[model samples]
Target: MNEVFAIADEVAVFRDGAYIGLQRADSMDGDSLISMMVGRELTQLFPERDKPVGKLLMSVRDLALDGVFEGVSFDLH
Candidate 1:
């Protein structure tokens, strides 16, 4: 995780209660770490979308969540 890389000097991966391996946090990336944990090389964690992005379908203005958040606005396309 980002936190591990930020604070730790080395990272150790474990799977199914067994130790996998250890590598320096500075020398490892998220994909590689995940691949080690999963026991496989991850080629495409997120597949590419087939279709191009479309126009805006919805819009939100001045959205609020009680005492949590307020004045939130966004658009979905």
Candidate 2:
């Protein structure tokens, strides 16, 4: 997938046979790519009401990769 950033100047993401959006490789990241593919923010994609919270299921802390990935976090039950 990093090759995508190396060779392509732009990428057009899609869903269900429909065009989603056009974006530059330099501007893309794991979070943004997931949002485009899922059609919503990872947080908003799954609401608390969909599942009970406050159980301390799983957590990601201080994840970073210099300029590539930074302060990214998530949780799941």
Candidate 3:
């Protein structure tokens, strides 16, 4: 018998009534995770290309989750 492992990277941005999601193959490494986060910009957080890292790292205070399928990921069989 054998066991397989997979790691996923995700970034979700919540809005007034909806949200955006992005995913990439991020492994168990700091540099890889940072690179993947930098690459995927399909949300408001990374909406602008010239947004500085400092701005990007700002505290997203009091963030809450409210959705029909909150915090769920989709996969194909």
Candidate 4:
């Protein structure tokens, strides 16, 4: 994304083969790009959950996959 902005003079955004809009590379951000592509404002892109997020939903500690990777870890809360 950074590389695209640095090298491209202009950007043409599209959605489902429909032309959304064209923008200068220097004048765009993630939110604006998403909004343009989806035809919705950033605020409306994600739904608001009624329940608040609570404590640790899941946790992965020192997970390793043989022959592929090792020592991977993460947590979802």
TM-score of 4: 0.62
TM-score of each: 0.55, 0.48, 0.19, 0.62
lDDT of 1 by residue, 1-77 (tens): 88878999999999999999999999999889999988887876666889987999999999999999999999899
The numbered model that scores best in TM-score is: 4
Best by lDDT: 1
lDDT tens digits by residue: candidate 4, 25-74: 78898778778888899898678988988899899988988999989999
- Candidate 3: deviation at residue 32, Å? 0.3
Count of clashes, each model: 0, 0, 0, 0
Range of the 10 consecutive residues with the lowest summed lDDT in candidate 3: 1-10
Instruction: Give the C-alpha lDDT of model 3.
Output: 0.41
Cα deviation of 13 in candidate 2 (Å)?
0.5
Q: How many angstroms is residue 22 displaced in model 1 relative to the true structure, after the best TM-score fit?
A: 0.9
As for lDDT, the candidate ahead, 2 or 4, is 4
Poorest stretch of ten by lDDT in candidate 2: 45-54
Q: Candidate 4 clashing pairs?
A: none
TM-score of 2: 0.48
lDDT: the better of candidates 1 and 2? 1
Instruction: Please give the RMSD to the true structure for each candidate, in Å.
Output: 4.3, 7.8, 15.2, 3.5
List lDDT for all candidates, in order: 0.91, 0.83, 0.41, 0.86
**How does residue 35 of candidate 2 score in lDDT?**
89
